[model samples]
Target: MIQHKTLIIGYGSPIRGDDAIGPLAADALAAGPLPAGVNVISRHILTAELVEDILGADRVIFLDATVDGEPGEVRVRSLAPDASAMSTMAHFLDPRELLAWSQTLYQHEPEAYLVSAAGAFFEYSNYTLTPAAAAALEPMIERVRELIATN
Candidate 1:
């Protein structure tokens, strides 16, 4: 079986302007030679498959864009493995809900966390992230690295 110590799931769409933040940051991290046991994947959407990807990982960090919060502000929340608390965003399977279901089905739940960057524009065909969002990327990446390293 493949094993990953840290898995970073970056979910977003580049065509939707600031929604691209997650993938962009993921790309930056991927361009580098990451620490041992680290893996990164970029996705245009978040799905139930993410639960499988996160399984057995020492730490799982989900990076995504959110618009219901302040622009450029980053929110780090430790989600409980409970379906009800999961935000039913645009995802087919809410992440927290998937985690809950996976725990019941597989008998294991990896340490999961979400780091969201607030987005300003999610317009169609706008392939550039907002200045504020772009500025937040480096810090976010560093924060994630630190979190994974310490845990």
Candidate 2:
């Protein structure tokens, strides 16, 4: 069995400016030695495999970027399986739906959290994160670390 008390999965496309923050933060966390009982994975936000990946973990935190809000504004929220605020995209299953499916299919309902950094640029380009978004990474990681440590 895959055993872990907490899991951090950072998902985003690295090529899309601020969208890269999640993966970048994931890399920073991965480079350091994590506390016991914690695990982290950095990847694009795809559904099929991610649902299976989260099964049985006690707590799961998914970090990503969102364009619907102010840039660099970090929003953290506990998400339920049926939350209406979630976005639905055919190419990507909503995170809440994935959690619900995991509970129904695998009998696991981990405490789910989403950490989203407001995104600015989504267009094609060789771009870097804006200064504000870059500044938020450390605090976000620190918060995740604290959550993992306490839970």
Candidate 3:
């Protein structure tokens, strides 16, 4: 039997309020025990170079903060490659775009998911999360754990 490889990427701006949740949660996960063949990474933002990282994984999970739902709410959604999801800016790449890169370049797109936490504040801060966003941290981590188990 072959071991499954899983990659977990948590990315966001560390100085931006609430937005830091992604990388922070990733740090927390890395500090604990994980299943074999699982690896965790924390990034300030997603970049095109990550396409190389995805090529070897069987599954990838992204953690980030979103303003789409109630503060402290956590959402998990599956992801697929989409070339049209391109970003005009050069600094960051959307998770889906990275997946698209893997699919186009290597013809191997790993099963992917985005686990996002709703944030109430996005103002510049000293590496801190708003109260509501902080409250969602555990739930966000728990959701990732569930995905790890079921996937």
Candidate 4:
């Protein structure tokens, strides 16, 4: 059997309202019919410590919330390492930079994709998801299902 070990990095602050979508995506994926041999992981942010985790994976997917689109919009796209995309993030690392790091540090590169749900209303102290973000869940998870089904 061909085993596809996929590492899912879902990062966002759970307490930061709509920012919680990333970790929530991890949960939705875990609860769904994810293919066997695929491994799921979640985090509040992608930091320096996840380098080794990325190195060992055959493929990787990143789940997060974005403000770059209309509320309730979901974006799914394949990602490649680009130096111009790198950022000096204080709490999180860009998915592109993560790919760049794995290649630079270990000469190991894996296919990467990003699934981002656009959200609005990131209210403070609101752990509950807003209606728009909640509406985005199904669409986001649907894309995730399709991404994982690919060899």
For this target, which candidate reaches the highest TM-score against the unseen true structure? 3
Clash list (residue pairs), candidate 4:
none
Q: Each candidate: what lDDT? A: 0.80, 0.78, 0.92, 0.85
lDDT of 2 by residue, 12-96 (tens): 8887788888888888888998977777889877465777778747888888888867777887888776534345565676778
Q: Which regions of candidate 2 deviate over 4 angstroms?
A: 1-4, 83-89
Question: Which residue pairs come into collision in candidate 3?
Answer: none
CA shift at 25, candidate 1, in angstroms?
Answer: 1.1
Tens digit per residue, CA lDDT, model 1, 1-151 = 5444988888898899999988888888889878888889898877777778767576778888889677888878876577675565745656677678678788668788888889899999998989989887987788787776664
- Of 1 and 3, the candidate ahead on TM-score is 3
Better by lDDT, candidate 4 or 1: 4
Q: Candidate 3, which ten residues in sequence have the lowest lDDT sum?
A: 121-130
Residue-level error in angstroms, candidate 3, position 47: 0.7
Provide the lDDT at 43 for model 4. Answer: 90
TM-score against truth, every candidate: 0.87, 0.86, 0.96, 0.91
Question: What TM-score quantifies how close candidate 1 is to the native fold?
Answer: 0.87
Angstrom error of the Cα, residue 67, model 1: value is: 1.2
Which digits, one per residue and each the tens of the lDDT, describe model 3 over residues 23-90?
99999999999988889999999998888889879999999999999999999999999999989996
Give candidate 3's TM-score.
0.96
Best by lDDT: 3
lDDT of 4 by residue, 12-128 (tens): 889888999988989888876777767788898888778889887888989999989998899988899765676665456788887888888888789899999998977778797
What ranking emerges by lDDT with the best candidate at the front? Answer: 3, 4, 1, 2
